[model samples]
Target: MSDTQPATSQTAAVRFEDFGLSADILRALADQGYIHPTPIQAEAIPIVLQGRDVMGAAQTGTGKTAGFSLPIIQRLLAHASTSASPARHPVRALILTPTRELADQVADNVKAYSRHTPLRSAVVFGGVDMAPQTVALRAGVEILIATPGRLLDHVQQKTLNLSQTQILVLDEADRMLDMGFLPDLQRIINLLPKQRQNLMFSATFSPDIKKLAGSFLQNPVTIEVARSNATADNVTQVLYKVEEEAKKDAVTHIIRERGLKQVIVFSNTKIGASRLSRHLEKEGIKASAIHGDKTQAERMTALEAFKQGTIEVLVATDVAARGLDIAELPCVINYDLPYNAEDYVHRIGRTGRAGASGDAISLFTDKESRQLADIEKLIKHNISRLQLSGFVPARSMDRRPRYEESEERGVQAGRGSQYGRGAYGSRKEKVDPWFLKPYEPSAPTTKADDNGGAPQSSSKPQKAKVAALLGGVPKR
Candidate 1:
């Protein structure tokens, strides 16, 4: 019932060979250096083989793809067909992802894991021609990995059919929901046969996610490998309390000083990614930016370049958060704290992958204090402070390294608390005397003299002006 508890298979068979995986799958896994099953893999694979709905939660880099892929491949190969009809291989499995990168990644893994098997798999996503995807569909494929929008497009074109799908997998379900694909996911789910096995995988199991799983899953066995939005322990996490102006230097310095070859730096926006990349280039670092503005081809090209070690640093937005798998990536830098706290886990997950030790570095400013607090609260672990050699926060801020403590105790501006007193040094906070006083009708009395003995009512008439350009009495 709980993902934390080791499954019977987990305790019984810690190695991949003991899982009774197809020889083909075992060979493929061995080729990929996958000797041991991850916790999620060990737990979920057996349940998936039993044909049960699985709602799984784990931190990023917990081998989720293999957990689902291995069993799905085994199940498909168990019923391999010998018919020669083009439609004989009618897509029996459909994997829905929010982004094209993930679709491609999952399909590659499926193909790799099923290398020695005769199973055929194809991937379809947006940002490419429909004709090629249509051609692939016409030839027939047993497994299809796709994005929701593009799948809907193929449906509209009468080129793809989910009616025969026997299994459904929503990889990164939380991300799909984050990308606003829940309605599209529901639409796709409606197209598939309701009796098919359903599997939902995500890094976090929020209430919304549980609700989403409830709508389709048939008494799913919940597998929570880690706490919701949890990060991995293998990653060395640190926070650099930096000034806004010093962020660029901090990132470049970290990369150069650490001698990190492969790094993914996450920014809050497209412009931020581009700007940082350009700055990194000026500092002699081979960097590239990937975001929504780039075409699919361009994004793929940049990602490939980064993966190939041609691009030293991959600067990107949240679009790459759910996908962008780089094996043994050394470090991940957060140029800006994520607006959503849960994303912090996803961003750092990029580095600590495949059981490899990695580093998660974040640049923080006073402005990002709230975001930092939110991240700490969601992860339930405070990030350790890291100081840069020969680099202290610019004195303009005159602020100490902050985590959640300041945000918790600090009062709002103009309230009963310190606002800019210590940091601004010698500059007192300007108090609005008029705003401080509560509004009340003036005491009705005659106009009072300097002696404060008597008051007199002297009414001043207001001047009238034209109300329109055409000329008219403004008011009575």
Candidate 2:
């Protein structure tokens, strides 16, 4: 018993003011200068405000945050409080994300939207000191945004309570499953009251996501702004085939040739992300890497720097880059094509966001043909393959041998005119012409002996034999 609402082209005619949202919410939207809602927001905001369980599926950057955040704020404002007592603000709405970045991003959105209202909000995640989080939790907040593990940690420590939480939102449910957060989700869900509103949103609607939604949501509305596993229409997708060893150089060449000022390069592995970041830095690009190996502080600093234009390139892994909402990101380069075809969709989704034109460029070697094909099949469209013209795969000059360096310097200083005998010493030696002649045996001397059959074998002189018995034998 679920309602299916397909997004329409007419959604463009809808405005934020028509949603019947509160003046506070509308004022906050106006503050951010958001008058019109994206397709997902147009469809989801009204339904979410109705307090019905919702299952939203949309492309990554089509205003999913505001779709749920605004209504949740409007609904929670009914119970909003200005009391000074900590008990006045109990966790009423809980938003769970798969990654810390997403949690932090969602928390920022919720805080901004709720700024004009009395609804207090807070976010908690791992990778940093929990002292600050514990303090915030003790201070009390109505809206709590957290990753499942961190939320459970706070619950276990008794610093937070969710028994009175009224609404539960699972953002990026598919990613949570990929991250193996099902058990955690179950545990956290068990801790909440069963009579709460459930809202789930994901980029793709896989079977596992559907099953999870069936189990968790009660007669929810299914909202799909685009087809499942669909790439954005505005994104220009292209691929460049390169040799394995030349992939790094290909990235540098592409960036330099295109003069791209701001872009995110997605790597499949943390090590690959870091390596690409270092390579770009060496190539004189302002680049930084964000991955699980980096501390939370370092990741945040890099993200902030990239957003502020201090870093031109933000190379990141899938997990680290999940839920990143960068405004007007012009391009995304896939340093390594993702193994999972669905990830390819998410990778490219980083660009072409919010109806903006973007380029999704990927560099793949021969070995990634299967991955490429799978991605094509999943997206139901062929990505244009282009040759990387003028890409000569830079060779490392630092690896030159010592002798070569000295020889080159000598030649430059007029020490030698040629590479062979002058720069390096002569490599040739003198040889005798006699030793070069073919092998020949001398003729045997056979003179006047006409009767000699074999020329008497050419014998040499022989010494006389000694007596068999000496002194005593003579007397005998």
List the candidates' TM-scores in order. Answer: 0.80, 0.82
List the candidate 1 regions with Cα displacement exceeding 4 Å. Answer: 1-9, 82-84, 392-476
Q: How many clashes in each structure?
A: 5, 0
**Which residue pairs in model 1 clash with each other?**
446-455, 446-456, 447-455, 447-456, 448-455
Cα-based lDDT at residue 402, candidate 1: 24
Q: State the lDDT of candidate 1 residue by residue for 437-473, as single tens digits.
A: 9889976435666888766675753356546776575
Per-residue C-alpha lDDT of model 2 across residues 1-476, encoded as one tens digit per residue? 35445433445778898989999989998899999998899888888888889999998889899989999999989889899777999999999999898999999998888889988999999998989999988888999999999888888899998989999999999999988899999999999999999999999999999889888788888899889999999999988988766788898999899999999998776766777889889989999999878899999999999999999999988889999989999999998888789988888899988899999999998889999999999999899999989989866443211221111112222233333344464434446799999999987544335675554544554446556675542333
Clashing pairs in 2: none
**Candidate 1 vs. true structure, TM-score:** 0.80
Give candidates' CA RMSD values in order. 12.3, 14.8
Candidate that would win on TM-score: 2
